[model samples]
Target: MRKDLFNLGPVFGYFFRKNDPNRPTNFNLRTMHFINKLSLAMFLVGFLVLLYRWFIR
Candidate 1:
């Protein structure tokens, strides 16, 4: 958490740079996209594992 914030500092800086206000800048957009995909994958994997366990029981 704290480490993530530290890592995201430069990312947020670039995200807030001038010339882009309405949408996230390129770096921020890419970072967010990657994070979203990763989280979704993790959620699906966990859900599948839970479903398998429930069916077995």
Candidate 2:
């Protein structure tokens, strides 16, 4: 439905939350964080590679 596509509250809530070290995280929350960090790191590496090729060529 058109409503589902526009309703982004849940998605935003999932990624933007308090980071309390003393508070324990469930398996799903930990997994999401890991994946988020991994993807961000990969993106930076790829961007660097692109810039290097651009400068050399």
Candidate 3:
């Protein structure tokens, strides 16, 4: 079967490949990781905005 970037093979290879282990299934860990990263970025942006407003006054 043809696999995309998010496929089990690529995803696992990208993340858990360093510590290989037998598992029941390959979950969508990559997606969750991406969401976590995005949330952090958004939080940082908001913090910077707040700081700028506090200082510019």
Candidate 4:
């Protein structure tokens, strides 16, 4: 519900947690996850740049 939609705990967890033993991983899945993490990192960098510009202006 609303809490689930707004929750950031899982997002931070995904960045920090160790891989699960029972989960299956493959080349494709690993590549996709890497792309996702990279995109998120890029987005965060862009957002911070915008914020810095706003504050410095």
Candidate 5:
């Protein structure tokens, strides 16, 4: 949505930034939001699992 994000492409786009109006809608905004949240959830879960393993063994 912002000018800065346009240069970063889909990596930042996955973090809930809306697609710029001039760009194509094939990616769809809602899907981006879902992916962002899912990614964050997985990242947190993975971090916790690693932390648990680090301390448990």
Candidate 6:
């Protein structure tokens, strides 16, 4: 469970890979993926901020 929580494979795949030729595209799916990417990016930013504060303090 902990390993799964930390796994970044799907995150990298979603952000870096070319679009799947065989995958179905729809408005709902696009919205979901966009939201996921947005959230991940926000999380990374927050983490970086915390790390910076830790080192500065």
Considering every candidate listed, which one attains the maximal lDDT? 4
Over 8-53, each residue of candidate 5 has an lDDT whose tens digit, in order, gives 5666465657657886555576578678789887998999999999
lDDT of candidate 1 over 1-57, digit per residue (tens): 465655756655553555546665688877886787678678879999999999987
What TM-score should be assigned to candidate 1? 0.53
Order of quality (lDDT) = 4, 6, 2, 5, 1, 3
Kindly report which residue stretches of model 1 are placed more than 4 angstroms away from their true locations once superposed.
1-25
Q: In terms of lDDT, which candidate is stronger, 1 or 3?
A: 1
Model 4 clashing residue pairs (backbone): none
| TM-score for all models, in order of appearance | 0.53, 0.59, 0.52, 0.86, 0.51, 0.78
Stretches of candidate 4 off by over 4 Å are: 1-5
lDDT of 6: 0.91
Cα lDDT for residue 50, model 4? Answer: 100
- Flag the better candidate by TM-score, 3 or 4: 4
- Scored against the true structure, residue 22 in model 5 reaches a CA lDDT of 89
Instruction: Residues 7-55, candidate 3: write the lDDT tens digits.
Output: 6576435544553465433457756766866786788799999999999
Residue 40 CA error for candidate 2 (Å)? 0.2
In order of listing, the candidates' clash counts read: 0, 0, 0, 0, 0, 0
Task: Flag the better candidate by lDDT, 3 or 6.
Answer: 6
What does candidate 2's lDDT look like per residue over 24-56, in tens digits? 889998898889867867887999999999998
| Candidate 6: tens digits of C-alpha lDDT, residues 1-57 | 576988879868879988888999999999998998899999999999999999987
Quote the lDDT for 27 in model 1.
86
Query: Lowest-scoring 10 consecutive residues by lDDT in candidate 3?
Result: 11-20
Report the Cα RMSD per candidate. 8.7, 6.2, 12.1, 1.7, 8.0, 2.6
Q: Which structure among the candidates has the greatest TM-score?
A: 4
lDDT of 3 at 33: 67
Note the residue pairs that clash in candidate 2. none
